[model samples]
Target chain A: MAVLTLAQALNQGLEQALAEHPEVVILGEDVGRTGGVFRITDGLQRRFGPERVVDTPVAESGIVGMAFGMAVGGMRPVVEIQFMGFSYPAFDQIVNHVARIRNRSRHRFTAPMVIRMPYGGGIGAAEHHSESTETIYVHTPGLKVVVPSRPADAKGLLASAVEDPDPVIFLEPIRLYRAVRETVPEDPHTVPIGEASIEREGTDVTLVSYGAMMKETRQAAEVLAERGVSAEVVDLRTLVPLDTDRLLASVEKTGRVVVVHEAPRTLGFGAEVAALVAERALYSLQAPPKRVTGWDTVVPLKKSEQYYLPSVGRIVAAAEETLTA
Target chain B: MLQLLTPSGDVLGEPPLSVDLTRRLYRAMVYVRTFDRKCAALQKQGRLATYAPFEGQEAAQVGSAAPLDPEDWMVASYRDAAAMWMQGYPWELLIAWRTGDERGGRPPEHVSVLPPSITVGGHMLHAVGLAWSARHFGEERIAITYFGDGATSEGDFHEAMNLAAVYGLGVVFFCQNNQYAISMPRTAQTRSETIAEKAIAYGMPGVQVDGNDLFAVFTATAEAIDRARAGDGPTLIEAVTYRLGPHTTSDDPSRYREESEVEQWRRRDPLERVRIFLSERDAWTPEWQERLETEASTEIERAVELAEGMDGLGPARIFEAMFDELPPHLVDQRAEALRSVGQ
Candidate 1:
């Protein structure tokens, strides 16, 4: 297992998927000879040929809409929308057709397709390039939403998404693309779609998060350990088919919880995690669940983005709120 | 626009359709018109859900769909039931969907027809994709998408057209310009003189046909399908027709259209010219027409019975189709649904 960045892991995963399944094709703008805007699909077109790794026109809806038809027509399509912000143009196809095909046709047609978009607000990119709008996809029924915080998980989860019978929204954290590197295993293995990964084991309080915010969460857990506070860190790899059992067990063990995400405060994914803890582990809770997330406003330009994204200090403060209570 | 048989049954051009083929098309038109009228009546009686009657566009739907192989893909809109049926979809399942059941959205596995797209214009890409997939697999199978004059205003329409041409994908963009999109007329939909002319910008051939003339639609679609099969890329066919009935049973034509205009189209009914042509050959008679209507009625009644007979869909069945296997949350929700239903 050679060390690889998150972007390299994703490229290897797609290359392996294309080699393994003749029916699989990758289509997106600049995905061909130019690699990708992020180079996540770098060298794929040259390695696999243009047919399997395609470069499409600058139409998000067309890219997704055509891929939906390809999927319905029996090809497994992996589409890359440049950024999470650009995904709105294809939301109609994603919501109406891709997500509803299997249920609307009653299993006669299934969209065995994956839509990957880089998301998060750490990078000082152009407008609409660094937003975590995964809540919208997670809210849509009949879709599997998976986000990976590490190189190994990105490769494994992507492999599973390509093979899944239904459509999957695989959100890659743009911030973590080059920030972390690790030895990713070879392809043909899968990190199950519905399970969560426990990043750190502790007992005093639990820090639950996913995607880019996991970095800060792990930092906060380390700081809490130095300050004589044992904080458990739970990385929710799969948001839709949430590992509710593992989450509740952790909540019950710590008897306190603090959820974190890069998305806005109201109606964010953190709200759902908090609600789940309240519903099942309320009796075991020593304090009410709290959240350390972005403000209920637009993800600002890079200059002030640090104020928007939850920091380790903010996460530690929230965890201490539960501890003090 | 190309016209083989005029409104008054006078031939302007001799189409390549054989007499036997003409008779077969004539019979199919009669059946579709009968089905269309029956559905409108059923909707009035609250038997079927609000139906989009294709009373005036029969020739456009039936003829354009005639050349498609059963194995080819059909992606049509709500008003193109006739086209869907022509592509070998069962009348029962098509009607079942109108009964507000998801099961009706399902067609037989071998029938390569998607559920009729309710929203406008988005399905055009689906056709392009199906044809693209066919070409990628080294197969000659082409896909046809049916939309209306109103759908031309959509962004997806332009995108689908450009993509199909760029890839030289095997697809037919069949637009039935039926005069009105709800209350708005076709003239207000676009400034272009003809919808077919839009294909020029995309470097594809465009044909405008007398949609009421079945022979003309058949000839145009056959040529387009042939061009697609030959890997010559997509073609756009604008079938200039009229919607004699309201957009759906819920709509009222009197609100936006005049009776005189409707009367003017009534004289050019798609079925009448076919009857006139058949009568000249002594192959059609008053007796034959009566027998055909009787047969169509019986056939429709059988389909209605089957569609109405479907039952026993329990609450759990609602969750069955969302995923291959229900996720943990859906499983919990399914149980909750069953409990709410007192099961």
Candidate 2:
């Protein structure tokens, strides 16, 4: 086991996939010669001899549509969208074709491809670089959406996403690229796509979140613990095919819940989690499910990004409100 | 021999583009025309749900499709039944799609063709992508993708054309400018004088041919395909044609167009033009022509029976194929569906 950052974990995962599956290929802008904008694909083109690691012609829809065909042709394609904002052009291919191909074909074909994009605000980036739009993917059926906050989870989750025989939208928190470090287990087994993990166990209140929000949620849990309020933290590894059983069981045991995410509040994944708790574990809840999410407005420019992201203070306030309610 | 052979029927040409191929071309067009008419009637009788008839556009489809190698790929829009049929896609598959069976319409990977795209211009991008791969991996196979005048209005059409042109891919953007996109006239569809001219923007060769003229369509398409096979890059061929029938089972053309205009197009009907050309060339004979019509009718009748005899598809098949390997939640959903259906 070797300690690695989120960037290194993702790179190790891509390397492992290349070694394991002959059909596995990588495509993205700057993914070849420059090792990707983040260097996740660094040393890959040289290792795989460029055929398996492709640098596309800066066409988002073209990359996705062709990857869809390649997957149908019995190849496993792991495509990287340079940024979350740049991925919108390929949204039609993702939702209308890639996600619906199997359902529309009545079991004749499937798109077992992975679309990797760095998401969420923070790091003072320009417009379109820091949007947390995971809810949109989670709303779409026939797509598996996964978000990883830690380096170890990034390795395990990405490996699982690449190997899964279904279309997956893997959203990595860009701000956490070098923020967290942990031992990246070589030859680590893939984590199941729809399972959530209990990062910390406590009985007072549950902090439920995924992606970048997991960082704030964990920090808030620590802050609450200093005041003797033991917080239970649940990291939702997969967003679309959510681990409802794990979340409901955790909230039922804690008797309180606070859902957190960086997407806007109106119809984010947090709302879905809140609705699920109200429906499935309402009696066990001592209070209504609370939500800590971005405001219902366009994400402000980099100068105001700190205000846009759900902060540790916000998660703490939401958890305390859940306890009081 | 089939009637309506090309004027060049007597002229000796290359092995694949010879006078003998004229009779085969005419037979295919006539068969597709008859099939289109039968489908219209089926829609009226409610035996088929809806259909986009390709009555006067047989030459454009048959001419372009005739040159494709079995291993070469094709992607088509909704109004491409003639091309799909000529390419040996089973008639039963089209019937299944018309009858609204999800399982019935996907292009067989073995056949190297895609199912008809219902969206206006969506499949063109796929065609460009596949062709790009062929060139990238050193495969010489070409891809032909069909679209309509309405599809030209889509952003996807321009995007696909630009990408194919830049990559020098082996893709033929075949556009059948069939007068009207439902009710909107071609004049209203684009400000440009011709759809082929749009190709010039992408730095690719553009050629315009009479879609009703089998000679012109055959010659132009064969030439474009030759250019593609020789690695000369993408070509845009605009087949100027007209749709003589209603847009679908639901449309009434009288609401949008003049009857006199329809009458004029009817006079220049693709089928009639070929028939006259073949007769003048001495390729027409009464006895053989009658046998061809009888054979086509008998084949369509058998196809209708075969399509109707297939097992009915249920709604649950929709969720089954969404993934190659079912995830855990989907497995649960499959079980739930089974319980609901008492399976």
Task: Give the alpha carbon lDDT tens digit for every residue of A1-325 in model 1.
Answer: 8899998899899889988999999999999989999998888898889888898989999999999999999999999999999999999999999999998889998899999999998899878988898889999999999999999999999998999999999999999999989999974678889889888999999999998899899999999999999999999999988999999999999999999998988889989998888788899999999999888888889898878889999999999999989
**Residue-wise lDDT of candidate 2 within A7-112, one digit each (tens)?**
9999999999998988788988899999998888889999997778988777788788777766755578899999988988888888887888677665566678
- Superposing all C-alpha atoms, what RMSD in Å does each candidate have to the true structure? 0.9, 3.3
Candidates' TM-scores?
0.99, 0.92
TM-score of 1: 0.99
Candidate 1 is graded, for docking, as high
> Which residue ranges in model 2 land beyond 4 Å of their true spot?
A18-22, A46-52, B1-19, B107-109, B135-140, B331-343
Candidate topping DockQ: 1
lDDT of 1 at B155: 97
Runs with alpha carbons beyond 4 Å of true place in candidate 1: none
Check candidate 1 and list the clashing pairs.
Answer: none
lDDT of each structure? 0.92, 0.82
